[model samples]
Target: MKQKKKMTSTGFLLLITIVLFFVMYAAGMVIFADKGFAKPQMFLNLFVSNAGLLVIACGLTIVMITGGIDISVGSVTALVCMVMADLMENKGASAYVAVLAALGIGLLFGIVQGYLVTYMGIQPFIVTLAGMFFGRGLTAIISTDMIAIKNKLFLKWANYRFYMPFGSTNKKGKFIPAYIPPTVVIALIVVLLCAILLKYRKFGRKLYAIGGNKQSALMMGLDVKKTMFKAYVLNGFLAGLGGFLFCLNSCAGFVEQAKGLEMDAISSAVIGGTLLSGGVGTPIGTMFGVLIKGTISSLITAQGSLSSWWVRIVLSALLCFFIVIQSVLASAKKKK
Candidate 1:
């Protein structure tokens, strides 16, 4: 019962934040949107357009909750994206083959990082930081140019949209499309898997225990090294998945893709009330948190006037604000 209440409180906090984001977004639209601040499509774009980031952020959330961080994800994702595109276009691999290749690449990278963190006793931060550099350097070596995916299967998947006709169309001549985006589907799958693992599975409970107190968990006979390794391995794998979805969405991959994504992922997890101090969080919360971050960028982009840099600046401020709130809240909880 006590745990349930805590979950409720955390959920309420998340809800309040979502409301606040909407308020800020509405204000921005009113002042900035030239067409009187009313557009239905704007709302749709929030979840659909930035869906790839949403997926990646969700994956990053899992690693953060384990009392660890992964900085290499952004660059690794870029590499996966490039690999997928290159394989499909130049190597004439089918979309399915390219996907397997991308995921396999992600798995391989995850294994390397996991081995370092768990076996070598390297700090997750340092290990992943090295990973970040290595991945980015490889991406640089691969090419700085944006490569597009012209594969027919890939193109159809990207453009596939579901439409629900509501009075023909809206003010922008856009239909009320509820079409599924591959990125959104992938994000949902991640969310569902995380939910099941964290809530209903023994491994998930073990994860929580490990994060709560690594020494205690080890003394309790939990396989600390294996769990930690899996955390990082999974993190790397998800980064790769995020990369594939990202490239699919943009139809290309560049060395600079998903830059600063680690920060964004960390921010999303923290904002969702996942403790940086370790232990306690839900993928559902993380999903909402990513949506909030994505929404901010979408609002800014919709205006088409504000510099894209504002997206980073605005998110940074919000990230700090949420971190402060979390610190205060955690301290108060401890005092109680």
Candidate 2:
């Protein structure tokens, strides 16, 4: 009965998020029809622009589902970008080598932070806060200035686009093919893999159990600590991959790159219906959250007069709203 209730609540939250996204997007299409908000390319641009955030949000969802938070992901992304930029631009490293280095850096942080949180029993926020500082400090140490990536391979990856069979026509009546970069493909794959892991894998079940109640999970003979450690490690890896994708989009790196991005990831997961208290989230829902974010940004840009900061403002409002909803549902469950 409890399981059914959990499933029902999860579905309810996800449905709300999906409906909200469509409603907001429809409004944009109607209000900005002259501005091409209805264009297919405009819709595709959301994914193209936010692929990195999508991947990072998936990682955040995983950690949050385990009742943990990592505020260091934004710092990690900055560090990864700076390191990759320094490697390929200055040290003459191949893009492939730089990519491997990014993954290694992420793994190193994951191992260290995960060990601290799981084995040492340190609070996750404290440990990741220190991590956040360390990562940003290390990024500045690499170079405070922006390093633009001029590597051929890296540029090739950034420039490459896959065109769709269908698209909108231009003023000249020429069909402009809608396209996406490899980053979108990677983000979508991450979402699919994470959804599968949480839904079908034993490890995922253990995570859910631990998040629901640590003592109960222990009673069930689940390796709670190890599972949490693995969760952080996986999150770190995704942070690295997401940072790389972000770099592909920008083709540059600086100390301030991806600043405050951690909040964006957290908000995306939350707005997607991932409970801050843990044990409830879906990657598919998170994807829609990201799309919602993208839609808001696009809408603001289309409006032309509104400041971009409105995106943050609206997201903050939405975040608070969902958190309240989650609390209410949780309270009602307790009463039942």
Candidate 3:
């Protein structure tokens, strides 16, 4: 009975998110038709542009599912980007080596943050907040100036595009094939794997269990601390890879990189039907949430008159809307 209730709630939230995305996209298509918003390439750009955020947001989803939050993801991304940039541009390191460094940086943060939160029983917010400051500070220590990655291999990966068969035509009636980069492929794979893990894996069940009720989970013989520790570790690794992907897009790194990204990830997860209090969320829903955000940006850019800050205003409004819905549902459930 409990499982059924959970499924019903999840499905309801997912349906709302999916429908909202399509509605927003459709409206954009209608309003911005002259700007080619209806084009396949335009749709694909959403995925291409936000591939890194998608991955990072997925990691946030995992942590949120366990009723824990990590506010340091954005800083971690900055740190990773700075480290990679320094290694490749200044140290004459190969892209392969930089990749290793990215993973290692992420793992190191994860281990420390996870240990603090789990073993030492520190509040996740406090631990990750310190991490956030440390990461940004360390990034500045590496270099105050920006580092543009000129590594041939890294640029090759960045510039490479996979063209789709169907696309729009130019004024001369020539077909223009839509293309996507490798980052989109990687991001989508992460989403799929996360979805599968949450829906089918034992670890996923444990996450939901602990988030739903830590006491009940402990009574049921679940190791709440260990599971949460693993979640942070995994989130750290994803944040690292996400930073790499974000770096791929920018191909440059500085102290100010990826500022406010933690909020974006958190909002994306919440808008996608993940409860802030925890125990309920899905990667598929989060994917649509990301699309909705991308659509908002594309719409604003196409309008050309609106300030970019409007995107935040609109997103905050949507975030508030969803939180209200979640609270309403929670109240109803309690009453039942």
TM-score of 2: 0.97
lDDT of 2 at 277: 88
C-alpha-based local distance difference test score of model 1: 0.76
Residue-level lDDT of model 1, residues 1-336, one tens digit each, is 233364644565577666776787678677767643455555555667666666666666667767877788877888888888778887899999988887887788889988988899889889888888988888777777777889999998888765534323567986654455667777788888978988899878887888889999999999988987887778777777877777777888678877887777777777776777677777777776776787777667767889989988888898888778777666666776
Which 10 residues in a row give candidate 3 its minimum summed lDDT? 1-10
Per-prediction TM-score, please?
0.89, 0.97, 0.96
What digit string (tens of lDDT, one per residue) describes model 3 on residues 1-336? 233454676678878899999999999999999999999999999999999999999999999999899999999999999999999989998999999999898888888999999899999999999999999999999999999999999999999999999999988999999999999999999999999999999999999999999999999999999999999999999999999999999999899999988988888999999998999998988998888899998999999999998988898899999999888878777777
For residue 275, model 1's alpha carbon misses the true position, in angstroms, by: 1.3
Clashing residue pairs for model 3? none
For all candidates in order, the CA lDDT equals: 0.76, 0.92, 0.92
Give lDDT tens digits, candidate 2, residues 1-336: 333554677788898999999999999999999999898988999999999999999998999999999999999999999999999999999999999999898888888999999999999999999999999999999999999999999999999999999899999998888999999999999999999999999998888888889899999999899999999999999999999999999899999898888988898999998999888888899999999999989999999999989989998898899999888889878887
What's model 1's lDDT at 252?
Answer: 82
Give the lDDT of residue 255 in candidate 1. Answer: 82
Ranking by TM-score: 2, 3, 1
